[model samples]
Target: MSEALNRNYRLCEEIGRGRFGVVYRCYSLATGDSFAVKSVDKSLIADDSVDRQCLYNEAKVMQLISPNPNVVQIYDVYEDDSHLHIVIELCNNSDLFHQIANQVFSEAEAAAVLAPLMAAIAHCHRRGVAHRDVKPDNILFDEWGRLKLADFGSAECFREGEMMSGVVGTPYYVAPEVVAGREYSEKVDVWSAGVILYIMLAGIPPFYGDTAAEIFEAVLRANLRFPSRIFHSVSPAVKDLLRRMLCKDVSRRFSAEQVLRHPWMTTT
Candidate 1:
């Protein structure tokens, strides 16, 4: 493990852990700056080429999108015998998931958060990248309350006239097209974003079931119920925006650019 700790970074403490890897709070030995280091298990890399490609693709995407403030920056990627380490900006605040689990956000707070989130997604779309996974857990906040879209392990680049088919993303946030096992484009990401927005306003996902099959059925059927009590204070324009974004028809779903122009998103 000592050899895994490169000369430039000193691993401090574990900050997060998941199926892919463990994230550690590390400091740069050169500048003494703090950053989060995500170390992927080398065993996984050797076991699957697709998984390795995913990590490489994520690193490439992060490099391309790092200039945007709403996207997390990947400062470095390195590998030792046992692990692949990725160093990124350290965000002190919790993710949006924890915040929503506590309670739905107020209109102003929701707008503030969604603004940057949409902007980041728009950036990705413009670059031909589809962040197939967009959920509350993947949205992070910094110390100053600025929102950033994180986690690109499931993202892929698509060209015009091209389509991807597969079941991907969290069940509650996946688009109907993906669940139906049909080809889909970036609009699937818009659907997931809509789900995230709905949860932010209502404190829970619109669809829920005991099993994956039931959840997929609900998504395919567009069975979404808005809780008036929780979102009564939300404006009609906002609700309309959510409706458009959550549309089951991929062609009808609001694009990220269109989402930014919705009446509810206007500064006035």
Candidate 2:
């Protein structure tokens, strides 16, 4: 498979890295198109089958959810004795995580970035997919400035009324229910989005600490706050929408569809 891939794609440079491996920007000699190729090291995995299946499952999930404009497309995948290579859409503008870290974002700016993501997430939910990890890094943009939701490694599809139990997600963005180790549903994704929204508007997470444990503790307390130092200029209407989305009460947490129609997202 590795030998065949070279005929189709010429690896240009290392573009980025993911939890699994390093990503390279590749070009198709046949089509003159650019693509991202993630090369996961096979030697790192003691159980090769598990790694293979995990990657295969992620690819399948992306195929099921994609052809929609806002989701990353998995173009092709192949494996060599040394590495497993997955071809994906190349997002030239980097990701939302770096954007949040490097700049200050206004409410309108944040809402504009979030509107497409919420719509994409809603589309995933409608198809029974739970993108359990909805952090800033997973959101990326192409050269055309269209943002797409990337990374389905932590995503899963669940049936109606099904409950999932596992402590999964980035520590800072994880919902309280996941930390509590309770049976949870797709709504946990909404909670993650709330955390992302908070960071987008405030330039920092609502719950934060120097360590992962401290942050987890802050999440468990589930206290939402707006410090005047950061949010003084933020509007009441924006905060109102944030409150609903960030509602620690799972029952009150806004769904992605509900979030789309929220006053903050809809208004000029």
Candidate 3:
């Protein structure tokens, strides 16, 4: 595979790095198009079999949701003796995390961001996919500020009676069920998205602490509150919507499709 790598992609420069791999900006010589190449070093991967299977699973999940305009496209997957390479659509702008870290978003900006994110999540649910990891870092934007959901490495397809036990996802965004090690479903993504929305409007996570345990405790026990100074113009209707979406009871939580039609999301 190493010998054939030069024939496939011409690596440019390092673009990003994550727990699993280093992403590189590359060019496809065959089509003259640019792509983000994620290379997972085999030596760095702790459990070879599980990591390889997860990589293949991620590729499969990407293919399942490829038709979605708000989901990043996975172009190719390959592996060499040294590493596994995944070629993905190159997004020009940075991720939502960077944007939020810079400052609070205006109501119009928040609405614009939420629209595509909701559509992407709805599409995933329609396809029976649950993106277990739905954090600001995974929501990327293009130059036009159009949002695209990225990183399906922690995603899973749920079937009837299927139950997931192990906790997965970023600590601040994880659902209570995940923290409890209880059987959980797709609604967990909705909760994480609600957390993201809260951050967009209030400029901070609803729950936060110095330690993971404290964060989990905050998530389970605290009520939602928005800083008036930061979100002075945000309406009660919007707050109500966030509360519903972030409901501890998964059954009572609003689905992505339902959330898209909520009044706060629809009004001018």
Candidate 4:
């Protein structure tokens, strides 16, 4: 519309859409570089204004973690009376979910995705930001094939040893303590990452069911298993890393920094 084009960025075509709004290919008039822009109407968001507050929190958290290439680049935030425009790095390949949905992810390929993300997660945690959500759909790859972490709407700033209580992540990846409604920390993100890695290798979520409630039940019990038929090809060290990251005990979960230096991350 006129609102978008008049903002000095030319909107090309709609590339994708999510709970927030539509994403489009946009080019900056001043720099001539192209980027992706997400446009969301203020009225079409969530109840209790949680969605709007999440939008603001996402911006604040991203601004705090700027200049990290492993994370999505948020160029600017613009708002009109009707909509909020978030200009961000465009990823032609979209998200990792579709790619993994169609094929198996070899150990190296999984590592390729996890290493930088571990680093990015480390960066977020070091800055006291818990991403809270770390699903495959939020992992994007640029045109050059560099993986970047996206979607921080569920993110929250945390202090060390602080316990946060909230059921706030994709069901399949939610940490056990979170499902149990117990106090939790940034370790929740590691559990989500562990679930992602499991899916990448097993071609299915570790905790899955016919309904969301069943899945939540499985998560509450920390029911995790590597079916021999599925994980038959996986190496022990990689499985060991998964066990550590997916630990039911939040205190035992591997931190992002520990995951980054994990042997499987460095091995072929």
Instruction: Please tell me which predicted candidate would have the highest TM-score against the true structure.
Output: 4
| TM per candidate | 0.93, 0.93, 0.93, 0.94
| Candidate 2 lDDT by residue in tens digits, 1-268 | 3987898999988988766689889999899999998888867766756555666677778878877889888888887888888888999787998899988888878888888888889999998889888998899999998989988877888898898877778998898989889988898888888888888888889889899999999999988999998889989988888889778888888988999988778893
- How accurate locally, in lDDT, is each candidate? 0.85, 0.86, 0.85, 0.87
lDDT by residue (tens digit), candidate 3, 1-268: 3556668899999988987779999998898888888888877766656666677789899988996789999888887888888889999688999889998877778888888898999999888899999999999986666789999988988775577766788889998888888889888888999998889888788999899999998887746777778767888888888988889878888999999999988983
Q: List where candidate 2 sits over 4 angstroms from the true fold.
A: 48-53
- Measured with C-alpha atoms, the lDDT of residue 193 in candidate 1 is 85
lDDT of 1 by residue, 1-268 (tens): 5364677899998999988789999999999999999898867665667778887788888887777899888898887777778899998688988888998777778888888899999998888889999998999988887888999998988886789876779999999888888899988878888888888888777887789888888888996667778777778877898899999877788999999998888862
lDDT of 4 by residue, 14-128 (tens): 9988876889999998888999988887778765787888987887898888869899988888888777888888888768888888988999988888888888899999999
Query: Model 4 clash pairs?
Result: none
**Against the correct fold, how does model 2 do in TM-score?**
0.93
In candidate 3, list every pair of residues with a backbone clash: none
Off by over 4 Å in 1: 1-5
